[model samples]
Target: MEKAKVYYTDMHTTFRENLLQKIQRLMKSAGIETIDFDKKYVAIKIHFGEPGNLAYLRPNYAKAVADVIKSLGGRPFLTDCNTLYVGRRKNALDHIDAAYENGYSPFSTGCHVIIADGLKGTDEAYVPVPDGEYVKEAKIGRAIMDADIVISLNHFKGHEATGFGGAIKNLGMGCGSRAGKMEMHNAGKPYVKESKCIGCGSCIRNCAHSAITITDKKASINTDKCLGCGRCVGVCPVDAIKTLNDESNDILNCKMAEYTAAVIRNRPNFHISLVIDVSPYCDCHAENDTPIVPDVGMFASFDPVALDRACADAVNNQPVTPGSRLDISEHIHGDHFCDSHPETNWKTQLSHAEKLGLGTQEYELIKI
Candidate 1:
């Protein structure tokens, strides 16, 4: 495979050009204008930070990207799917509220915000993954699947499960509908939380597979019949249905890669990752700890895998921040992400993505 081109620009800004302008310049220099954006629905996938977590990307960056798309005559919208976990972003209504709360309103980003999944996170499109070993079909949010073009605007950071969240993480796990997320994070089926179940019958009624039943004023899942579609989890009024999250970290990485392939396959896609505020955990958390390293820079590429590899390399090359998580931890592995989250190997995502022919990990970084 040939080395992909990953364009980069440092955080340093001149008096005349601010970060926003720099981002626009970076995108244009990286050939963003080459795409036929004229009159197309472009989904700019991003993580609207969990209300209290301050590590997610700002709306300014999104606006820059949106403005670029608009310049090319495209219709752009900021988007993200509802999260599987209990949080402000669990459902479409709540997810939009969270995005607004985190300063991602249309008024701020120069574009509207759309929760890719419909209300309750059940609206999805089953996309087939031809090269998938773990997932045959990826259940992606309907709104995301409906878009004509896809652009992943990611905040590069460490993850407890995936080692680091980058373009692949943003597109794969981030684009998954509730069921798709369940499939990626769990090796087994979901179970009813007896204590939380109020015998509401919502789960039983929503179960298309007849996998759930109510007994003794409690709900129980028949794992044999359960398909792990996660519909029960979405419909439970009381949040009683829950996934086991039993998938091993490595398998989780591989599943995420397959999900990513399902998203970008046969679609016009681009990727950009900002390696700032390098939090040690995912933005899904309500709180974020100190950054492990100094801000690296911004990166853009047509190749998601190569973009991720470049960003990971940049973060790994930087010096650790004093008093950050990495500074205090025992650095057994030389890699910063590995040292931060010892249980995870971030390379698995890139390697699996490469095997799926998403893109190569080898990249040539072009500094602007």
Candidate 2:
């Protein structure tokens, strides 16, 4: 198989040619023009920073992509699935507000913002992959499933569980509905730490299945009733409900790979990863820590797995900055996320993604 072409450009421009222009050129060079966008519904999957997190990709980049799609006669809309964690993006209403608050309004991006899943994050369509590790089928947002083309505009950053969140993370975990997120997160029940439970009834209120009930001045989860949706974990005032710790990161990464494969199987797809911010954590967090390294610019590709692997390699090759999160390591040639977060092995996602026929780890980085 020929190496996947991943095009990149360094962040070097003053006033005339900005990152947005560079992205447009990069996409074209990466062969995104091959897709026929005429009258097609293009879903531009992106993370609208969770209200307070400042590390998400800029709206200007989204606007550029939307413009390109529109120029090709495609009807584009910025979309993201509702988050599972109790945060600003837990539902469509709140998620849309957060997107607008973060400056991704339809006026700005030249497209409407649609939370892929409907109001409660339960509106989903099952996409069968036939062969999968943890999930034989992916529960994707109905609107996302309905789109004619899929494009991921991802903010590549370190992830606490998966080592790093890149294009695959953006497509798999990012596109899954809140309930779908629960499936990828844990195979066992979510345990409620009674000590931290305030019995505020928030969990009981948010749980659609009434899985949580307060009793004896403490909140307890009815494991029998619980579907392991993980809603209680987010709504708890105290850090009470939590997923089991025994689950391996490799398992989680593999599940994510399968879910992502379900989204793009037999569909026209494109991906772009922005390596700016370089935060030590995912943008899903309420706050972003200082960057572990300097901004490396942007990359675009037709193959998401190849694009992600290329970006991870680029980040690993750069010298770690002093006073940053990765200040300890003298050696940075291997996986940077693993060195930064020793407990995580990111290769699980890459290798599993390749096995699932999503894409390959081998890629040729063509500098644009």
* Most accurate candidate by TM-score: 1
Worst 10 residues of 1 by lDDT: 236-245
Note the residue pairs that clash in candidate 2.
Answer: none
**Candidate 2 Cα deviation (angstroms), residue 257:** 0.2
Candidate 2 TM-score, C-alpha based: 0.88
Stretches of candidate 2 off by over 4 Å are 14-16, 190-246, 328-334
Looking at model 2, residue 223 earns an lDDT score of 88
The global C-alpha lDDT for each of the candidates, from Candidate 1 onward, is 0.93, 0.87
What lDDT is reached at residue 69 by model 1? 96
| Candidate 1: tens digits of C-alpha lDDT, residues 144-228 | 9999999999999999999999999999999999888999999889988899899988888888899887889999998899888
Quote the lDDT for 185 in model 2.
80
For candidate 2, what's the RMSD? 3.1
For model 2, residues 21-118, the per-residue Cα lDDT tens digits are: 88898988988888999999999999999888999988998999999999989999999998876789877888999999999999999999999888
lDDT of 2: 0.87
